[model samples]
Target: MVDGAGSIGGELSPVLEVGKSLAAPIWRQFMYLYNYSTNFKRLEKEVKKLKNTRDEVQHKVIAAQRNVEEIKQNVKDWLTDVEKTITEAEQLIQEKANNPQCFKRLCINYKQNKKAFKLKREGIDPLLQKEKEFDQVSFPTIPQDIWLRSSEDYLAFESRTSMVKNVWDALNDENVYMIGVYGMAGLGKTTLVQEAGRKAEKDNLFEDIVFVEVTQNLDIEKVQTKIVEKLSIKFSNETERANKLYERLRSGKKILLILDNIWEDIDLKTIVIPSKMDRGGCKLMFTTRNLDILEKMGSTNNFQLGVLEEEESWNLFRKMAGDVIQTHELNSLPNDVCKECGGLPIIISTIAKALKNKSHPSDWKVALRELRAPSPTKFMGFLEKEYMKMAFKL
Candidate 1:
């Protein structure tokens, strides 16, 4: 740059001095070509390595896709197999439930091919391992004597030996005695049947006695479960519940089945009620406020459980009010209370117990007067208005 900017006095011209640079384009171009070639080769090598890695990854991805498909197919196949086994199990159970002999045969068959059946039935896919935890098998428990509004009716029936014997014979009869006990609420229809259950058990009339409550909210599955549980059948899944119940029940063992508190009409065929062969000498008993339910259950003989007769009413009342009688000074009040109880044991018993601690006739009179008033559990009005209506109509 200093040489190019020469002094004006004695220096060379600036334009002439600046034009003296070396012209070496040919050498620079050659060097550039050589470096480009090296860089191109290096890029080619890196591209080749990337291609190799991509090929490996693609192969792995293809193999993984195939494996996933294979797993899916295996699961589907296993599910198909399981469903088939469940269908067969259910059919077998239905057969056995209908006939006690089939139950015995199924037990034998199950023992023979337990492994094959399990694999065919449920354990085909390991993914469904948790499904085994879900249970359809419930063994029946010895139900406590928790009589709901039916105990008193049964108690009254116990006093009638002829009626008791009639019921007993009908239950023991071979032609599947379907006895219906019909009444209104608090009239003791349930009580009568429970009393019959106690008697049946006491008399050793059957190999087993089972009670199934068909509540107002009736589910056939629940009824089926109750029967199965009572019978103590071992079932592992929903598909097996019905079959297992049938197989366990088909032994031709004389059994008494109590169907209690039936609210609606249920189809016997749908519910798997035993026919002549499957019945195994089973007797079916039903109690309901709905006579329609009784008719549907095929009650050959229906017993209309009425309010306690006057004497029976007094018997129940005196039993409950003995404490009241002892404590109260006026003896006339006991008769007054009984007269007002109106021949309903439950109402009389409940009121008598309520009045047991009170001291005065005024309290007794008030209780009696209240019962006569428009209120729930109006003991006297129930006989004249409610019980008679239910007895004749229901």
Candidate 2:
């Protein structure tokens, strides 16, 4: 509950003031959230566009492949035809030589046509060489990007732009950057990272993008098989699963792995991080709330997520409320109301939604009073603690 009118206002203003000073480029802070939203919408539009493009490319490549196959078959048939022709020609020449008088007129004509025989041999040799090269060539399959949900309307996340971009750039770098993106519950860390993975895949930054949610109870074998399934590689024997995974991961291609909801420090050796990949760079991105777990994971860097700005928070609250509070009189109290929610987007949105049906000033005051209750952070912390417990069990 938010105490909108009393001591809660005192607490809200100072936190907002301190947060603004602690974070630079205040508006720039929201870049990741805004860019993610924009990119997601663009991707949605391009998905259909790319589908048509892939269909067209597939049709063209298939036609080209078939033509190459047909050429090889034609050469095979021609070779058979030529073999019969050569055998018949040899027999004719032998018979003509043996019976010179019988072949007197024909012998002169056969000698005169030797130039045509040379031309036939020359044409067949080049065609055969071409057929061999065509047989060796294989066309590549068109790549497809996976579709994940967009985060454009997720107003609570509008201020996490820098941290998101840092993670994105780090993942896109040439080294395996193990970066951690952590936040209190419902700050949209998983959603933002997933969207980043989708974007990376679409941009061709990686050959493969994998998403795995690691729960508290760890199963090493299960994780291995899941990765194999995602890559569409087969395992002849379950015993060789780890070996096969190691081999596949080492085969020189950039892979972006998203290990979401990670609570425990994962041993890279057991996961087979493929230290010897022929590919220059690959990445692993993890999301968690526990700082100690991240440190144990040997993170190259860590990002701590904070609450949204007042303006952004209010905007998100308004959007969630929709047409219920259209006029200035109703809207004027939101900043005072929002501040009491401790700048947490989840809390703000939840409260805004609960009061969407109420239009009177007295009702708004009652709602604010509830928010100002002593257990505000604890209320939000309850969900985070449960989720964190579940995430780290692995």
Candidate 3:
């Protein structure tokens, strides 16, 4: 370039004029014969390497998806580019191969050579190293509780079976934005709600189903964090989490969010739960012990879970207490114990399981006496709901 420098495009430099005599031979030796022709071969070799590298990346993406992961955007873009480049290269190679090894072939190879060189320098070579960073191509996309289907441990009581159907139907109803499930403590409200979710999932009623646990005390950050974790992203704008969540949910339609064990009414939006959804759009299902709270939270359609009847209660009790209750010495005693449970499945389960290993009648009699107490001192505090004390009454 310095030798070719000139005075304002008027005259060539003196040094360039002196070297001009060698230009033709130099061009034929390097640019025409050695470089262009060899670039085509070089391009072919590099293109094969590119395809092999691309196949490796494609395998990673497929494996990641099978593991329930979301592929990164760049990885997808790279794969798309690989497909395009390979397709174009394949066509160019076929066209150039049809030409004879003459000037015509050189002309054809010229274009293919530049493309192949550009692809290696700008697209393939750099990308091969860059793509290595994407070996772990995806991330876990589903939330911990997205897998919250009903398990075998779920007591399939008559009332719960019917209520699960009812909840599922209400959520599917177009006008229902939120559905409420309320029952006394220990009525298995959480379990029934999960069963409803299980059914909805089986039927593909929603694109995504997430279960959130909201106890008597609300933790706004904890709630928001749970949602963020499900989305497989981070949002730490302590104050702006709700707004961010609102936008995300608005854009991502058809999500079913189940909030379990709510003690009081809460503004769903405050936790980033969208207030508006399209027809057959996102819906909320919350479980609480209070229908009043559910109504306050805008759940006009509510399902009240009833306690198990005597027979259902007895059956559940027998299942938990096992064959020990069927022994001749303990058989009739189990009936009296079941009655004291007042058809409350949790209480029946608790009392029956407590007596499960007691082979002696004296131990069973002592357990029956404990069930009659104002507060079952041996059981957990949550097991002492007012109804529990009342049910223990003789």
Sorting all predicted structures by lDDT, with the top scorer first, yields 3, 2, 1
lDDT of 3: 0.70
lDDT head-to-head 2 vs 3, winner = 3
The worst-scoring run of ten residues by lDDT in candidate 3 lies at 1-10
Candidate 1 residue spans exceeding 4 A from truth: 1-159, 326-331, 375-394
Worst 10 residues of 2 by lDDT: 1-10
**Per-candidate TM-score against the hidden true structure:** 0.53, 0.52, 0.61
Clashes of 3: 0
User: Which predicted model would earn the best TM-score?
Assistant: 3
Where model 3 places Cα greater than 4 Å from the true spot, the runs are 1-134, 137-150, 159-162, 276-280, 376-394
Candidate 2 lDDT at 336 equals: 71
Q: State candidate 1's TM-score.
A: 0.53
